[model samples]
Target: MSQSIIAKRYADALFQLGKERSKLDQFETELLTLREVYRDNNKIVSFLKHPRVSVDQKKKVMTDSFQSFSEEIVNTLKLLVERHREDIIADMIQHYIGMMNDAKGIADADVYSVRELSEAEKQRLSETFAPKVGKQSLNLTNIVDSSILGGIRLRVGNRIFDGSVSGKLRRIERELVSTNKR
Candidate 1:
């Protein structure tokens, strides 16, 4: 099976277990932390993937590193190590988080602006855009992007609502070119 398919299956199983234990929120939090650690530390993954490392050593390392994490997450990491599927850890965590977010009616969004958005602006954007995306609310991450020039560009999932000045200019340019072609 494909890596994504395997990851999704693991995520689904973890999600079901989380629901059964009434620990979905906690598991989500732990998964997020694991994602962050994996992102920031390449050495950890490298160490786990090293051919010289024994499965027992890898499992011990994972358990020791994440002793504070819940048993479910720790066991999952150990299982991944044992199976030599460390590469899918990040994808699995992401899928699990996505499942949790869907259950909570929340969507993660990136709002790109020329400057850092104020809390009020973020709240207003969340309010205006959440319903349009069929989500109760958005967990907005503001990205200061000078390339947008002005206005804001909001991205939720694969959809991008581009209201930036540069985006508008590009749209107009496209229209003009298409009109000229005709």
Candidate 2:
């Protein structure tokens, strides 16, 4: 099976468990913490994938490091270790977080502007664009991009709403060139 399929299965199972136990948000937080740790530490990956390491040793390491996480998460980590699928932990967390966000009618968005956006600007953008995208709200990640020149560019999924000054200028230039050619 593809790694993504395997990751999705695990994510779906965890999502169901979280939903049934009324701990979806808590599980999301735990998964995020684990994902962040794994991303920041290459040594952990090497340790998990080491040929000389016993499964018990791997499980013990995970348990020791993530003792603060819920039993469900810890158990999942142990299972991954046993199955030698620890590499997919980050993918599983991303899928689980996506499921949680979908359940809550939220979409993750990337907003690029020349400068950091204030809370009010974020709120305004969320309010204006969320309904258009059929989401209740947007979880925006602000990116400072000087290339936009002015205004903002919003991306949700595969769609982009480019209202930046550079974008407008490009559109006008395209129109002018096409008209002249005709």
Q: What is the TM-score of each predicted model, taking all chains together?
A: 0.90, 0.95
lDDT per prediction? 0.95, 0.95
Q: What is the lDDT of candidate 2?
A: 0.95
On a 0 to 100 scale, what is the lDDT of residue 58 in model 2?
97
Error in Å for residue 169 of model 2: 0.9
Task: Give one digit per residue, the lDDT tens place, for model 2 in 1-182.
Answer: 99999999999999999889998989999999888998899999999999999999999999999999999999999999999998888889999989988988999999999999999999999999999999999999999999999999999999999999999999999999999999
Model 1: weakest 10-residue lDDT segment is 97-106
Query: Candidate 2 — which residues are off by over 4 angstroms?
Result: none
Pairs that collide in candidate 2 are none
